[model samples]
Structure formats: C-alpha cells, structure tokens
Target: MKSPIRIILLILGFIMLLSEGFMGLPFLGGTYILSLGWAPLGSNITMYFVMFLITILDRSNESRSSLSTIAAVDIFANMIAFIPFVGMFLHWLMFFLMLVYIGIVLNTREYRGNTTHYDRHRAGETVREYK
Candidate 1:
C-alpha cells in the first residue's frame, strides 16, 4: 500500500468486474472453480482502502473535487452493483472509472519544497497582514 496502491486498486477493480460475470454461475454446487464467494466484500474493502490512502497521502495541493469524485464513484458502483441486469452496465462503467481514478491519482503532484495550488489560492489572503 504505497505509491503502487493505485495500481493495486486498478487491478482489483478489473478482476472484480470480470468475476462478477461468471464467478456465481452454477457449475459445481452452483459455483465455479474461479468463483469468488465474497467478491462484493472484496470490492468494498479495496475501495475503502483506496479512500484511506487518498486521505493520508494527498497534499493541500491536491484537488478536493477529484477526491470527492473518487468517493462518488465508489458509492455509485457499490450501490448499483446490487441491481439485476443493470449491474452489468455499472461494472463496465466502473472499469472505465478505475482508469479515471488512476489518472487523477497520477496527476496529483506531491509537495516537495514546492508551492501548491492551495497555497496560491490563499496567497492573497492571510490571517495576519504584513507589519
């Protein structure tokens, strides 16, 4: 769970999407060899971990809107996944969203002795005026 966390989430989301297709199919006792019995739980765990990572890693420079968008995606995916046939659309949309999340994560620049957008936003306003 380091910088590679984003990659891990991407892979997990993709695998979960695929598993949702046939993992529950009735092959052996209504289950397949590649079946993931608790796939939704896995997805939830992975997504929450991602939220945790974002909360801890992001600098003030990072866009709050993007973070909120990631949370929104997680919420929407989880909610829609329980539906019947419509859930399939959510799965595909989620795969695309995973890519979007990765892009946002990759675009977020770390604060390394550099001023951030947040800093610039407050540049004109300060608690104390110059003496």
Candidate 2:
C-alpha cells in the first residue's frame, strides 16, 4: 500500500481501538453501546469495511493479517454481544486481541529484504557449482 494510505489506516485502527476499549467499559456504559442496539451492527459493518480495505489496498502477496482473522471472530462475538455480562467481557477481550493484531499489522513489511535461492533458480540464473 502507499505510505500515506497505510498511515491513514493505521491511524483509523488506533482510533477504533481506543473508542471500543474505553466505551466498552461498564462504568462508561459499554454494555449499552454493544447491546442489542444498532452499535454492534455499525461495528460489524466497520469491521467488514476495514477488512476489505486492507485486503484490497494492500498489494502485497503475503497472507492476510491476524486482524482480519480476529475481525472474523469479532463478528461472532458481536452476535453474542446482546448477552448481558458475557458481552461486556467479550468486548474487553476483543480490544486486547485488537491491540496485538494492530501491532503485528504495523510491524509487517510489504516486501522481503532479499530473494531466496529458489527465486534465483526460478529466474534461470546460474547457481554456484558444487564439487
């Protein structure tokens, strides 16, 4: 992805992380926010948008990031977020998981530093002769 776009996404992810983490607390009325109301639906849609944006904007051939995978799981959790106590705990857990995933996503590089021997062979380059 372009550097500017990547930075934008990283920023957006952090914002979402903060919003969910703080608002998810019971004292802050997180339960109500994640309840059977429209919040979960909005979050689910945001998750889908983020997943698709990352997958599409990211031109790298590497496999999808853990965030995408966790987002998939979050969908299920959101479904059950209608539950009373369980939903609150799940939201907190999801925040922690998102923290780890965002770290991984931020640290990942778009390109490998060097090509492997297999790449040389595939390109029909001469290999060093062995005795």
Candidate 3:
C-alpha cells in the first residue's frame, strides 16, 4: 500500500479506538446518547463509514478478515441500536469487539514475516539458492 494510505488507515484506527471512550461517559455521553433513540443510529452510521474506509485501505488478506469483522460488528450494533431495551448492552458489546480487533491487528504476524524475509536476504542467501 502507499505510504499516504497507510498513514490514513493508522489515523482512522486511532480514531476508532478513541471513540470507545465515549461509551464510558455520562448522559450525552456514549450510552446516554445512544439511548436517545435515533441519535445513536446516526453515530453508528458515521462509524460504519469510517470502518468502510479502513477496510478499503487494508491490502493484506489476513488484515482484511479482521477489518471485515469490525465492520460487521459496527453494522450489527447500529441495527440493534434501534431497539429500546437492549441497545446500550449491544453498544458495549460492540465496543469490546472493537478492542479485540485492534489487538489482533497490532499483533498480527504479517509485519514479522516481512522483516524475517529481509533478514534472510541480507544474510546473503540468494532466491535461487533458497529454491
């Protein structure tokens, strides 16, 4: 991926992680705002938009699965937000899911593989020799 694209993805991921804090605040806060009925739907819509952008920026197949998982959770939470009693609970559940997704992305082996391959090449083993 291009450097600019990667930077944008990193920024967006940070924003999504930060947004989780809203879930903890008082009324007019995460859950309270969500309880306001339609407003939560709007917030969730914004989240879905951001999530979609992130998904598009992800190039690696392994990373795509985690991004899609996060998108699915966001969509599900938004849909459930239309409910009266269970919306807040679903919101919290989605928040935790996002946390897990972030952790998975950070600890993924994709970056490690690249570094390991570079090290092997640097150690003077030619591609033909490996084969």
Top-TM-score structure, candidate number: 2
lDDT-based ranking: 2, 3, 1
When summed lDDT is taken over every stretch of 10 residues in candidate 1, the lowest stretch is 25-34
lDDT of 1 at 47: 65
- Tens digit of per-residue lDDT, candidate 2, span 39-68: 754665476467545755566625455556
Write the residue-wise lDDT of candidate 3 on 1-131 in tens digits: 33454455556566655564464343445556645757756766687677667666667535676667677777767766555446556656666776776665565544322543346555877678875
Candidate 3 or 2, higher TM-score: 2
- Relative to the true structure, candidate 3 has a C-alpha RMSD (angstroms) of 6.4
Alpha-carbon shift of residue 3 in model 2 (angstroms):
2.4
Runs in model 3 deviating more than 4 A are 1-7, 24-37, 109-131
Which has the greatest lDDT? 2
How far residue 10's Cα lies from its native spot in candidate 1, in Å, is 7.4
TM-score of each: 0.50, 0.64, 0.59
